[model samples]
Target: MEDITIHEFDFALINEFFTELERQGPGSPEETIRALGFIGNLSNKTKIADLGCGTGFQTMVLAQNTEAAITALDLCAGSIDKLNATAGKLGLQNRVKGIVGSMDNLPFQNEEFDLIWSEGAIASIGFEKGLNHWKRFLKKDGYIAVTYESWYTDERPAEIEKWWLDAVPEIGTIAHNISIMQKAGYIPVAAFTLPESCWIDNYFVPQKARQEEFLKQHAGNKTVEDMIAFMRHEADLYSKYKQYYGYVFYIGKKM
Candidate 1:
């Protein structure tokens, strides 16, 4: 979701892997609307910021539903270019614009946005830090909707748990995240776990296909081989041990 530094060869392979997909993360437009439904009263006056908006898939969904101005920010210029082109084609050029930037150093002014949305990207700067850093950019009483990879249960396979611990920080149950939200100075409006279809259907299933294509194209490249192995490891792990952890969406309003 967020940026990860990788070898140049793996980087090329990965950029190719995701280039053709509408969504880079495991989310559907329907799920995005479901989260937006929790926030009431929308109008042209509303302004939104979508952090780490890979290719701006969800950004377009938001623009289509609301008359709000949205800035889709991402670290990848190629992603921003695709987002811009899509926004233009959808005739949402005035409402949606893609910015190439980092989430940690948001370029917008303090209290400028009415809503801040992030999907599977908060971990780039750590969840707690992301919340604290982004709050300044949101207006008073504005909402922030985000999804985080979380531990669903306390008891789990030690090996998988260790793998996740190394991959992401602040792995916790729903209640644990709710506590974190309160500590970050937001009042929860709604919370729910994303359905598994979000992963299997939207993400891994397509990712698997992409991997297959890469194997044929980059046949003997060690970089592609290592990259493919790592990517496959995630899907394989989830296939065997999905119940232990998953992404959960939390909607909160700034206090």
Candidate 2:
């Protein structure tokens, strides 16, 4: 038999990974809605594109709170399916559309949307590239809002920096986020850091508990073993880089 790859992990396992991440409070969908609300009113029935809209949690929020017509995109087919199902259940099917696609190569015409939103996904692609690539999709004077992992202080520990470099080699330091937006022809409108407690309470503990339960159920399954290994590698990096780090939400207007 050929060696199975990490990408070959069952959809259930991947779903478990993200579902657990969503259960934590403060980082929940409600929090995202409130955060974006702080930037400006979303009542204009604007056309919006949500890139990397995992499972459509934030996308649904935007749909509910704003009169905006939303197009939600994700790379994972399963996630896109769940998003669509949720949208239908919420009666937002007409207002929001889901697409399974890549952020690097958006499948939309130039100036297609009045606003673009992303959360916890741009790091998977390079931040600068993601910002630059998606900018063209925004209409002139349109807004782009994104949440990225960033450090709170100007001084960062070497180990923490190394961990980020190794794990997410593409994202530059937190200090560079604003500058990246500016260089991409976006005028920075607002910026704020999410609390570290959000991650600890929401992502780390719940995911760890879920993984433990899975281990008990699956026993010696090889796929389970691979999942455990991959998760531990990521957790180790997280711990090493566990300082006063959080997501920085940047709201920008296209120039």
Candidate 3:
């Protein structure tokens, strides 16, 4: 049993832990649809890129709502395979295709997508960098929609602020984020904070059963215990300081 930080855990272990859940992070289908409403003119001909699509939860939601062809990309092979299988079962295999790849190095042509969608995954690459880099893949007037952790107010409690800042140094106030998006060559369209239900009900609540099963299977594994403990701490932090910060959906049109 060795003491280690969450980041020190093997990537494969982390991916495996998340693959059992429908969502790797805080979000819901309702929030996904709400974000989509800001973007218009979608049709069968429209192409969408869903970067960091963990198991394609939101991707499936997108598929159900629109006729757009979606390329759901993620770094985890297991997640991609599961996503593809789920797509097939849901009869969305024709429109929703999952590929395993890094978000920063997308395998697509310039100006290829009508929409770029990412939920709870932009932090892997900094938000500003993701927006700037992904812009090349979007057609003119194309929309980019993403959910990133952002501060709800100008100031927050020191404990929560330090915790989040330590984890994601690039985190900023919603206004600051919008300004960054504008500077990165986009017209910020709509910005909204996901409600607490998305975190408490849609995200954390669903993990309980899976967490218990995971712990039972990995009984006596220190790393597994450490990972679950870390996740529980994150949930506690969110519950305690949810009023100060949460995931915010930012929508922008490529300028």
Best by TM-score: 3
TM-score of each: 0.93, 0.83, 0.96
State the lDDT of candidate 3 residue by residue for 8-97, as single tens digits. Answer: 677988998899998999999999999999998999999999999999999999999999999999999999999999999999999999
Show model 3 residue runs off by greater than 4 Å.
1-6
Q: How high is the CA lDDT of each candidate model?
A: 0.86, 0.76, 0.92
Candidates ranked by lDDT, best first? 3, 1, 2
Comparing candidate 2 with candidate 3, which one achieves the higher TM-score?
A: 3
TM-score, structure 2 vs. true: 0.83
Candidate maximizing lDDT: 3
RMSD of 2: 4.1
Order of candidate numbers by TM-score, starting with the best = 3, 1, 2
In order, how many clashes per candidate? 0, 1, 0
In model 1, where do residues sit more than 4 Å from their true spots?
A: 1-13
Once model 1 is optimally superposed onto the true structure by TM-score, how far is the C-alpha of residue 51 displaced, in angstroms?
A: 0.3
Per-residue lDDT of 67 in model 3:
96
Candidate 2 residue spans exceeding 4 A from truth: 1-16, 19-26, 38-41, 216-218, 221-223, 229-241
